[model samples]
Target: MGQPPINSTGEARTIPVIEARGVDHYYEGQGGWNHALSNLNLTIPHEEFLCIVGPSGCGKSTFLKIVMGLLKPMRGQVLLEGKPIEGPGTDRGVVFQEPALFAWRTVIENVEFGLQMQKVPKAEARRRAQEVLDVVGLGHVTDLYPYQLSGGMRARVAVARAWALRSANLLLMDEPFAAIDAINRMALQDYLVDTWMKDRRTVIYITHDIDEAVYLGDRILLMRPSPGRIGRFFEVNAPRPRDRSSAEFAELKGLITEEMHRFSSENTSIQEDAA
Candidate 1:
């Protein structure tokens, strides 16, 4: 409930829960040094759902890791709640492309795994795990092993685990439902929106699907590949529980698609002119 520093002009601003400034990162590979991210910056206020979408080679995932402190930026700093993120901390929760569940652990157990490791009281952990599982619609399969569940069920369990384990200020997701089929993907998207609405944590979600971004993000930031940089950004002014089939939703999606095309065209022109 603290606030950001007041500016000279005397306007008050709510401090962003997360802020990245002048972030640049690179990697050395067989092809020589490759820049993964370059001078990227953004600020996310409390409980904002910011989805990042870009082409394959863009550093969406890289940026997510940087935010998580799973990896450090070569340059620039990421701050969480006004303090610099030095490394992975309990304030962050992450869901990856794969469920990464323990094959032997049953659904409830998998959801409770992280809490157990953190030494949470057994009864409390089980209670929270059951609550999240029920929320994610996995309560029916709570005793089933990972192998026994369908892909969608596995994805739900993974999400449930992340949500249950921490009272995280930030939730970092990297294409968590991408592996599921379309129907299942839609279901998971609804679940995510519900959970986020209730907890109101600042969430950074990385995905390649434009529809997914449009559906879930309060704003979508598109990235450019190869020395990844933030490109265009658009705010989805639609209301929550957005109607995918509605005209407003279609228009927002169209606007993003058009911007992407224009961006791609300009990039190609610049590349050709240079060549």
Candidate 2:
């Protein structure tokens, strides 16, 4: 769903949910400090589902961390709702590559974990957790423990857990379905989109899969490696429940794949030249 930039007064009021201004990060690597991100800048508007795709060493995860406030960049700043992000806070909820569900906890309990941590009343936490689980089609499985749930179910639980945090307006996902099989991955993607539609939130999803990015993102940000920077951004205007086999989908996927290949080829040439 496209969001209009205008407000009640009929004037423009489009403050971004997340903004990165001249962000730069470095890490100690094999040869002194390596540039992980360089002069990167981006802005994600309210309720925008933005997917970031690129090859390894492209600082996709690094950028996610900057947004997450897990690591501070060497230069520049990241802003959330127009304020600088100083550290991790409840305003942002995260899902990682692994579901990392608590084996000792049931599905409902797992989803309620974050709410409880925020000092929400037990009854309210359970209620919200159950509500979110139901939205993701996991209501029947709420009583089941993590170990009893299949990989796909576990993934759904992870998503529900993040979505259950009512105060968190931004959801940051880092390849949450990467470990699942192809069929299950697609199924989880559908579930995620359904949940997103039900309750819109600003989302930053990082993945290596081009098709996944195109399928889920309102806009796709492609990054280049060797001092990771913004390469390009693609707007997915095909509308949801996107047809994966359609010509439009295929064309967008092809364009992103071609750009990724170009980055890879350029990196290879640089390595050869260095040798």
Candidate 3:
């Protein structure tokens, strides 16, 4: 599905719902410090659908972790709702590539996990869980366990769980649709777009799929691999429910592909020259 129109009047807008300023992350290992992210700056406006795309090993997952408060930046800051993030909270929900559902819990139980942790009343939690389950079209499977459902269904449950925690202004998704089959992935994409249209929640989606990024994102941020850094950012001007086969669609895809190839080849040349 296509994204909603963004207000272009350029008024003094409120602070971004999520902001990463000069984010530099590194992992101290036996070998040395592995720089995962390098001087990154990104801002996600409220209710905006932003996609981050990069080559493999470009620290896309690490970026998501930083945003979700699962990891801290060594030399930068991550702010959500204008507050510095120090730990995970119910205010931010994550849907990973794999559905990390508890094996023993039923669908409804899994959906209510966060609320239960926060000491929400059992009755209220269940009611909210049921409402979100219906939103994600998984109301009928509330009694079933994760193993009983197909991959797509499991993903739906995960989305439902995230939606149930409505306090979260940001949803961090790391290739949530990558594992599903093409048909089901497309269906879920439509479902997600519909839900976004209704609720206008801020979403930051990370993926390697260029078409998927272009199709779903209001703006696509592209990064390069070695010492991950932003390479380019593209604002998608295509109309809602974009047509993949449209002339403009193919043109933009081709252009982005060429840019990606150019970046990749340049990096390869640099490596070879260094060697």
RMSD of each: 4.1, 1.9, 3.2
lDDT of 3 by residue, 236-256 (tens): 877677787898777877888
**Tens digits of per-residue lDDT for model 2, 174-223:** 99999999998999999999999888888999999999999999999999
| Model 1 poorest ten-residue lDDT run | 1-10
Model 1: residues >4 Å from true position, as ranges?
1-13
List clashing residue pairs in candidate 3: 2-241
Best by TM-score: 2
- Residue 121 CA error for candidate 2 (Å)? 1.5
What TM-score would you give candidate 3 relative to the actual structure? Answer: 0.92
lDDT values, one for every candidate = 0.85, 0.91, 0.85
Writing each residue's lDDT as its tens digit, candidate 1 over 150-214 gives 89888888888889866677788999999999987998899999887776677899998999999
Worst 10-residue lDDT window, candidate 2: 1-10
